[model samples]
Target: MSPNRATTIAIGVGAVLLTSVAGYAVWFDYRRQTDKDFRRKIRKQNKKVSKVVEAENSAKGARTQQDLISAIIEISQEPTPTTPEESEKYFMENVAIGEKLSTLGPDAYVHAATSFYRALRIYPAPAELMQIYEKTVLPPVFAIVKELIGIANVIAQQSSRPAEAGIDGGEGEEDEEAMIAALQAAVAGAGRE
Candidate 1:
């Protein structure tokens, strides 16, 4: 090849190499930023869930008569769920607590449920705790008990679907259900025992 042609080809190759390196740097920077953002989001979610778990745990330890009574009074005196919407709100919150309590050890479940039952005694009216007991407490407890259950039903019906699905089924499924059932049955059977 001619000298001029060789120099032009070399210059073209150099430009392509420079462009490739620049593209890679941009991609690496974007990947790093994305990872950092993802980690930050996870940390935030963990903090929120952890706070709720901690509150449930603290509630578990308050077993004394006065302590239990105080919580009951607080729940009872709180404005009764005046509307269906408000009742639903309370019920959903209870569901979350129930799901968490179901995963705690036997003692934790006993304490949590005992606290729940005592709180119910204070606010047994259909207004708050009773409604929640029926709505939130029972269903998740049942779900916690029955792992063979489905999520949206359709997803479960998909013949090719996985053996496990969603939050209800995964690595934590067995342990979570066992813990929840043990706590529930223990607290439930306490009066009989």
Candidate 2:
């Protein structure tokens, strides 16, 4: 082969090798960065989970009825102002209280119900307080917890049934009307009580 042709072929092969190495290096760095980011995110999430678990455990250990009642009171007294900020604050505060309430077990629910009924007696029968309790607070408190270790099918079957029979997912405007009527009836019943 001519020296010129040989030199040209050598140059071409070296360029190809250099390009391949550069491409692989770039890809490797990109993968490493993505993996690092993913690991950092996972660690952050794990810390949050640990915090929640710690809080739940501490709350369960305390088991103070006063704490439960106080949380409930905080939830109930959120301002009913017409402003968006007021409404958002109310929702956020209630969500925090709800999370705390979930940490408390079944006994806490009974106490909550008793406390609610007692408050109902004092609050001049069927007030906004009672309405909130019936609609927002009571349903979640009364939710039944099932421990499913090995019973996957059983859990699936149980979950399929709606807690309230009259309510179905596919109903449209008629469902809304029915819900309103039910609420009105509930308010009337509470007033009578």
Candidate 3:
């Protein structure tokens, strides 16, 4: 075929494709503007997808909460450092590990928090160390550590109460029970948010 003839055929094909595309666009726009059933179907589909996404997120959230609770419980159950030298060394190791893990990102937050909780247990003064953590630690990790401390306190109180009751002839039992109740409330409140 001649060059002019080929060029004419190409332009004709191009024009046909463009016209078809523009015609489809106009039809789509008109359907969207005037078709109530079509619009409602789209909305329903979107709502369905949104509900599924919400369900999945809620499932993930439930798992995360359970994991946090289990981690706190496990850390509370672990044996503690017995001697001053052992306590200091354990504290330093855990603090260093926690600090390093905290930098690795969100997926490592639980491990980091557990490490910090371990160090806090052996620290010479936990309240002061916590103040330092507040300044230096990531917020999520800090929150986890805080929850662990509360739950550990509850566990510690429960264990000691039995022994102390035996020793004190049951004196101050009410105060002990009240303190346990208060710590439980704090732990529950912290987990809510």
Q: How many backbone clashes does every candidate have? A: 0, 0, 0
| 10 residues in a row with least lDDT, candidate 3 | 162-171
Position 19, candidate 1: lDDT? 100
Instruction: Go through the candidates in order and give the C-alpha RMSD of each one to the true structure.
Output: 19.8, 20.9, 8.4
* Residues 34-115, model 3: lDDT tens digits: 9999899889999999999999999976566556555665666688889989898999999999999999998888889989
Error of 2 at 94 (Å): 0.6
Model 1 TM-score (2 dp): 0.28
Best by lDDT: 3
lDDT score, candidate 1: 0.49
Q: lDDT of each model, Cα atoms only?
A: 0.49, 0.49, 0.78
Number of clashing residue pairs, candidate 2: 0
Rank list by TM-score? 3, 1, 2
- Give per-residue lDDT, candidate 3, residue 29: 85
Model 3: residue 108 alpha-carbon error in angstroms:
1.2
Clashing pairs in 3: none
Q: Provide the lowest-lDDT 10-residue window in model 1.
A: 147-156
